[model samples]
Target: MANNFLRRVDLIFDQDCNFKDVLKSTYQRSNDDIINELLESGLKGRGGAGFPTALKWKFTSEQADVEKYIVCNADEGEPGTFKDREILFKVPLKVFGGMAICAKVINAKEGFLYLRGEYRFLLPELEKQLAQFQSILDELKIDFHIKIIMGSGAYICGEESALFESMEGGRGEPRNKPPYPTVSGFRKKPTVINNVETLVYSFMIFRYGAHKFKELGTADSRGSKVFSVSGDTPKPGIYELELGMTVEQFVEEFGDGDTKAVQVGGASGFCVPRKRFKDTIIGFEGVPTGGSMMLFNSSRSMYNVLHNYLEFFEEESCGQCTPCRVGCQQLKLGIEAVKRGERHATYLEQLQKLAQTMKITAKCGLGQSVANSFFSIVENFKEEMIY
Candidate 1:
């Protein structure tokens, strides 16, 4: 079934075949031309925020610097978002190809794949692929070296700044923005940080040009999205589908059962009840997410699921700021209060208000978006929380 999905998308990954050929063919253009083509195609970042990839490259490339770097955020720490891991294990070379293209476009001499520590077993396979990719680069004379940096299993490290800190051998915690990674990153050099899937799309955009790629999905959100569909589903796995496909269509494709709600994005993603699912489209404009769809049945306890998510947030937060460190603690405690039926209704309301504040004022994405799962679940499934 997975193979069928890959074939449908023209993905060049399969069990019997390694991706050396795909990588070789994807690099058929000069760096400048590839950048121009990407800009013309209008490819946005695949990793949630949907920032323009070409503009990001242009900005990073224009920085007058002797040394620059491109870092792939392979730290797929988003709970229920396993697309990156699937790509790593299956179509690694395509990701490498995209990284190489990014390096060349941004004039970066080095690239790093900052993979999650939980993906330690895939490291040996990645190392082997990197060696082969090095040979491919040498054959093509592409003048850049890429390295794989394993994260220490911290969810905070998935944030670009924290990932940089982890790469630099520091405790994984976010730094202040304004000196965003592009301006000052990776040993204080100009850097381009992109998610793993975003880099893979870069390969496609440059290869087929932007227009062909844009034909797949919505005007605002052009191209297909890879989703890690799990939780209370008969066929739970990674699915690559066009953006703008309604949540209803998605569930139908997966052989619909009693889906009470669907969580878009990851643990930090929003929850849409069955009613809203029909209106929900899969893209930045709708959910503003990274395409991680986790379904929940009516039998599933919304309270229990929320509790599990809170536990994850508590463990994964980098303990950097008062908002994330203390805020997560308070949220967890509040959930516990609900579980034990000890909190007043007003306390839940207070927790919701605090989450909103964290979303607005938190220093980094971790704290800012960490409240999404809880708030969305609470808002959409209020009856479940009423005890």
Candidate 2:
């Protein structure tokens, strides 16, 4: 454990007791009380967006849909992030219990665990766990049931709207906003979709009172965060820490001595170089992460990092909008062109502007977030990017 690392709520790893009875007893509480407790805890979505979990539940629960859903986004495809796979493999019942709790709150009869295609090998065991949970729910006389679906390994499916599209038997492309998922989602019904970690926390918040959950982390980012720390680090694995630690603290604990930069929150997340480590916080107030903390040392090339991310975006972009489709290719080629001396070093300014346009007009988060690391790496590591 790193400095200031506190693990109070245990849902997945190192859990001793079965949580089924706890979940069964929770139904005695009113939906309003549960949602209110969640709101008071200041719990945010662990799925990168950091949206308030209580608000999403309240929105879907208040909707007038006959059939509602609770979709657990287990498609942990973000590069260098694999914490969900461990949670699904080890303690899937907690996840299902969390989902069943949500279904009870929102009056949802059905729920789906959208497992990543890469985790297909864990399906048999996950199904077995779900069956066991289903039996528990049946014993409790809860009308809700859960089914598992596997994704086709698209990185874009990690996005909430795109995940919905994939769940609906269509290509995993993000839908436009305004009629957000709470209003109409998952076969055009009111739905509440939460990341695997978020749902687990929901169960934890219920188990331990909201006040206890609020004791850890900063004001905005309350509670613990499970980080999938990898790359250039001495110890690369999942570590749960109280949310408001600085990047410097994280690096000191996990990073190699030669660490130069840390990409907080995977490729789409911000790039925090060593210079800003002390000033940068790791929680929602500073650079909020979705469980990916990739440390890079002096040996790693910033240009290659940006190039790899751009390549991912170019291949993963749905290409529904011109900004994301063309901007990704342009950014990838722009960096390559500079490296090849085909384009002048000053051309990076123009490329930055192109990236800015993509942030504004791109259809989904996949395209908009490309500018985050792209501009950060290009601007900070210009010397390394160009000759």
Candidate 3:
């Protein structure tokens, strides 16, 4: 088993033999065998939501709908999440292999990789890689085919339902629940939507067997995750590190000595002040992330950070629901009012209360998760907002 220390693993990008070999062997296994292996491995989605990948596959496979689809959520539009783009650019074969595995398990013949509009530059090479990957699929006689779909640059599309809407030629907005992607997705059929990194991990798990991954992280946060580290860090880039490590340990490795706070997960993620670094674990048992870690030194302003996040949510909010639409607008305005000495510092509490309400009343994760960053910042750095 793995401990809480940050261990840099060579699982994801480590390549040895041809990827087709891995696919050839994986395709040999029964669906039950593969799903059982994935279940035992405890692999979860790397897309921050952390749903069990095995259950997603099992659920989709169990569904009676033969006209199912597999979706690779390449809409990496989160504020600080760029690892998926890097994965798609560097090792697209692993992504395709993972999709093919899922397709076999679910008995689907077609899939789509919802590419972010901002990443239009990667299209040409990505298509080139896709051709090669498809050739391998043909050689292996796997009927599964993967296609790339373009996104119109909406951050909400990172949400599965919203991405489905965009794919179906509708406006990029979140639909209501009770009809999740697994049961009704991508043309109202069963769909297994996996993140770009999650798919790579799936491919890696099947390539290296389940226990190799299951032995990496703590029980709840099994396996290593790739993080997109940015802001104030000397070594800001994509890193594949073990989970269950403290923010303090992460800072020791990636942060400057003057680091004041670390934002785990992107703008929507919780902000940890310097004082709380040691206590904060970067995993599901602590602060679950979609693999974005941002460091801020004492020189950086917490108020500005909060303001910037609020502005992001306000601009990104689909405006479908009143709480997110109004909450994002007011939170940004409310923080600004206090900063400008127009409102009493007590008004900060009101903003926090509103954030809490939005967490409950808002329709989707975009609206619900605002309170994660909002309250964490205001509570830890109240003085920043007042003066």
Q: Which candidate has the highest lDDT of all? A: 3
lDDT per residue (tens digit) for residues 1-387 in model 2: 556543433534648645876797788899999999999999999989999999999999999878999999998888889999988887788899889989998999999999989889999999888888888888888899899999988988888889999988999988998688899888978999999999988888888778877998889899888899899988999877788888888888888899999999898999999999999999889998899999999999998898898888899898888999999999999989999999999999999999999999998898999999987888889999997
- lDDT per residue (tens digit) for residues 243-356 in model 1: 777777776666357988888888888888898877887776788678678888889999888888888887888776778778888998997787577987668889998898
lDDT of 1 at 95: 88
- TM-scores, one per candidate: 0.93, 0.97, 0.98
User: What RMSD does model 3 have?
Assistant: 1.8
Which candidate wins on TM-score? 3
lDDT of 3: 0.92
- The global C-alpha lDDT for each of the candidates, from Candidate 1 onward, is 0.80, 0.88, 0.92
* Best of the two (1, 3) by TM-score: 3
Q: Using lDDT as the measure, name the better of candidate 2 and candidate 3.
A: 3
